[model samples]
Target chain A: MIVCIKQVPDTTDVKIDPEKGTLIREGVPSIVNPFDKNAVEAALKIREEKGGKVTVITMGPPQAVDALRECLAMGADDAILLSDRAFASSDTWATSYTLAMGIKKVGNPDIIFCGKQAIDGDTAQVGPGIAEHLGLPQVTYVQKIKEVKEDGMIVERSIEGGYEVVSVGMPVMIAVDKSINEPRFPTMMGTMKAHKKEIPTWGLAELGADEDKLGMNGSPTRVKRIFAPERKGQGEMIQGDDESEVCALLIEKLRDKKVV
Target chain B: MAVKIIAEECIGCESCIDACPFPGAIVMDDGIAKLTDKCNGCGACADACAVEAILVEETEVKSGIDINDYKGVWVFIEQRDNHIANVSLELICEGRKLANELGTELAGVVLGDGVEELTKYCFAYGADKAYLVDGPVFKDYRTDSYTDVIVEMINRYKPEVVLFGATNNGRDFAARIAVRVHAGLTADCTELGIDPETKQLMQTRPAFGGNIMATIICPNHRPQMATVRPKVMKKVEPDFTKTGEIIRVENSVKEEDVTTKILEIIEHATKMINLSEAEIIVSGGRGIGGPENYYLIENLAEVLGGAAGASRAAVDAGWVPHYRQVGQTGKTVAPKLYVACGISGAIQHLAGMQTSDVIVAINKDPEAPIFKVATFGIVGDIHKVVPLLTKKFKELKEAN
Candidate 1:
């Protein structure tokens, strides 16, 4: 099984500087995307039960090797990082193309796994994009794996109202949700081995990816501008000496609006 | 393509450093901006450059698809159990406006079994044309079958813009179709507009947990696609008197082509608490203290005849089920009334339900960001304010 992951800025740890009206990213640390961990954990669980190898991959800068190492420490069999200056500034389309090429170079695998979405971007496009590029069946937002057969597996997919039990064949791609499984912590021995394990970094040339579909030039979407959303306005603060008075005032105000 | 900082035009201003969302993508070197490998060609720095020092040079990769060939705005009318999804109607309403601005027709594309009657609702919601692909193979939403039919339709009749609701099934299949058709798709877009200058579809969505909003455009790709946020767009009242052309397309999707099979579907037994369809919601957060105190939130919701919700923190603490959680990772709700009790509104949580018509925040902390968006704020203990509000609301009902 091949699992795709991304290293993202811990958005929860990010803070806004009120005085400067800018993001205070100085102290904020980067971590493996929370949802991606669930993907890694799902892959590991399947490999443990089905007796196979789990390979983890990511496409980012040199620092992304840390994310790979963290996945390795979680007992993945191997890790690959696709990093190059040419691969910079890729949107979802380009990113998926590059990763699919990297997966092709890794050889055929029964199942490919990924997180539902990354916190930083929250696009949830890469997994399906990769599946299309690889010509594999895709099942997204998988909540649980019910039973594994020789040629296929039964999984529960989360929908709007409830869950749908789906039976998918092998050589398929699945993006897991956070409810899938609890990721395990790295053991001391696993950490030591992960630090020692050599992770090969693949570039555009190594992956045999077309340069036309590699980076910013390959991306179809372009960001015109990005800014903080404007706050609506300050709300009316219902103040009173006691809870009873405030509650009464609130009720009266809502009654006037007919929302109560 | 790569981002380059032209030293000749450099003014030593650091606006680019602040505007770039990717960490370590830009840094100051010798009083001038420099680009690192961390940059993901989003071109935010170039926009932020005061002196226009940053330049993004594309390698002139032609997509080979003629953008002019694509016309009209199409919305994928997602339906389940023969009932049209509300988000689909919402998109058709928005699509009518976009189609008008572009001087093109708005079409609703529906693919399902025995769903031809849904076409009338599409016309009522403002679609000028309806394309229906009805068959047994299209009975359920399987990615393979849905992608095949949708991709075929898109290829046959090119659309300049295709919109889908950013629901689980919509996102699941839209991504696949976008890739197959080589179209640019923006996910969970909160706003959609046509660029006045370029006349291209502009997709605007939140990034970095709603802290920043980015406006995106697909300049070179045809059929600019986006999965719109569920409740962000307003749906106009349906005009049943309106009529449209119904074009029934033959489905070529075979059962053998679908690799995944739906064994069973388990609908939520307690569907009454469906937050997305609720008119009012009372949500608790970390401030609710513990799971034992959750009844206060439930009681208030019960008194209001609405749904009980919880913040991500409350859900993470195992106080509530994930289904009842409200936030970016949870549900995006636009209820008529939203009462946030003890919920310190993080931007993530606000991204989910800030679109509610009326927001009432009850928190002890006056400085919480929840107050910024709340229509009514009460700086008091939720334990005290909640019970009193419940009692008072009940008394008002009794008096009436």
Candidate 2:
């Protein structure tokens, strides 16, 4: 099993001035998304139970190796980083295509696991887009993994009302929700092993990825602009001593507006 | 330009061929609807087809609406058991502001059985007009019945922007209506604005997991549709002196067409801590120590006359059930007063409760992120602070 993770600049760390919509990322630190940790944990648990190697993969700049190393320290057997200058500014479609190519390069695994969505981009399209690109069955928003059989797996999916149990054939893609599993903290032994282990880095050429289908050029959706929402009028706080008085006060205000 | 047909694994269903309202557009080929040039792309055929075998390509054509052409901004007034949901009233307040900005009127669409009395209340709140759809079929919310009535009114009146609360019933009804009318619908909007340049409704909402907000626009669609979350907006006061025109809408829905039967309506017993509807909420985190200490937090919440909540970490630790968890993975709450006891306030947790009117934090760690948004910060043991606050509240209540 191979799980792909991304390192995003901690949104809290990035200072944004409300008056001026600009991000100050100079001193901001990046971390593996907290949600993706659940995906890594799910993969490691499956590898332990099914006797398979869990390889972690990421596509980012050189600094992204830090994220892969963290995954290795969490008990992943191997880590791979897909980094190249050509892969910058890729949207959800391009990102999924690139990751799909990277997965193919690492020996077509039986299953792939990913976080439901990345925090920074907040587009839940990547996982579903990958499933569409690979022509594989997808089970999204999976809250629980009931069982993993030889041919398929059963999962509890979170829907609008409650939950639905679904069975999907293997060689499937899954976008795991945060409630799927609890990620374990890296131990001293794992950390030491991770320190000695080197993550193999791959580029577009190494993965045999199509240049046109690898980055912004391949993405269909383009964001024209990003701006903060216009604030509404100054709100009037209703005040009174009792519920009836408050209700009366509200009624008075509404009478003025002709709204009963 | 040629229209593209994206076939989604058709099972040779002839429903589309029989249901295409347009003449000669669809023909039966291999027991499936094969498209021809006569297809007008009106999508009535798609709606009638049970198999979902038809797809229509929409072109991005800009339609200009004269600023003075539209008269009023209306909100769908949703009610349960004859009483208005807080969200509907909240949207009316919001719609009033938008109507004022556009120099127009604000109206509320009230559809129910014997809800004529609610029309006066709508005018008292902020509505300049109340469109009432009263009938027995419209008594309980059924998807097809409500959609048909609402769509009929929208087609006749042609309001500029329509808003719905993002509740289960609201979303279901709104999605069906939007699909029926071939209009763009933005769901779970947190913010709404009018573009000064284009007069377009800018609908903003948390896209992923409250990680980033995206603003959407429907330039070509008539009567722009948006579904706002409950508690994200304020409800205005009702004024009896204010008056509006009460327009009675006759419903044409027959009892037989409604296939779903309501066997029995059994409402669940009210929860002790209804966090979603609470005006004030006091939540505990993992730092509360264990499940046993949750009682201290609950006691404080009771004294404050508020509901108790828990962080995802505490909930996952078996300290509380998942419903009480407040974060991206759990429920989003915005209350008048939010007290965080021992919460570290991760970004995900903040996403849920950052919109509270007033936040008070009590954590042992002085550097905890919860303090950043806390109006009152106490760096001490929650066990100590909670008990002290509970006792103080009791004394204050007794003195009063």
Best by lDDT: 1
TM-score of each: 0.94, 0.57
Q: Which runs in model 2 stand beyond 4 Å of their true positions?
A: A1-260, B1-71, B140-144, B195-197, B204-216, B252-272
- TM-score of model 1's chain A: 0.96
Per residue, candidate 1 scores C-alpha lDDT tens digits across B347-376 of 789978887888999999999989999999
Model 1 superposed RMSD (Cα): 2.4
**lDDT by residue for model 1 over A149-238, one digit each (tens)?**
888889999887788999999898999987788899999999999999999999977998889888876788887766676666788999
| lDDT score of residue B263 within candidate 1 | 91
lDDT of 2 by residue, B1-400 (tens): 1233446545567666544433467676665557885554445455556665555554444334343454568899887667777788889988888887777788999988889988887888899999999987888665556777888888778888889987545654665565445455666778888777777778787643444456666655567777887788887777889898988886677877654333323332324454656777889998999999999888877876777889988998898866577776666678877889899988778877877776777787878878877755666777766776677667756877
State each model's C-alpha RMSD to the native.
2.4, 16.7
CAPRI-style grade of the A/B interface in model 2: incorrect
Q: What TM-score results for chain B when candidate 2 is compared with the true chain B? A: 0.77
**Model 2: share of native contacts present?**
0.05
Determine which window of 10 residues in candidate 1 chain B has minimal summed lDDT.
Answer: B269-278
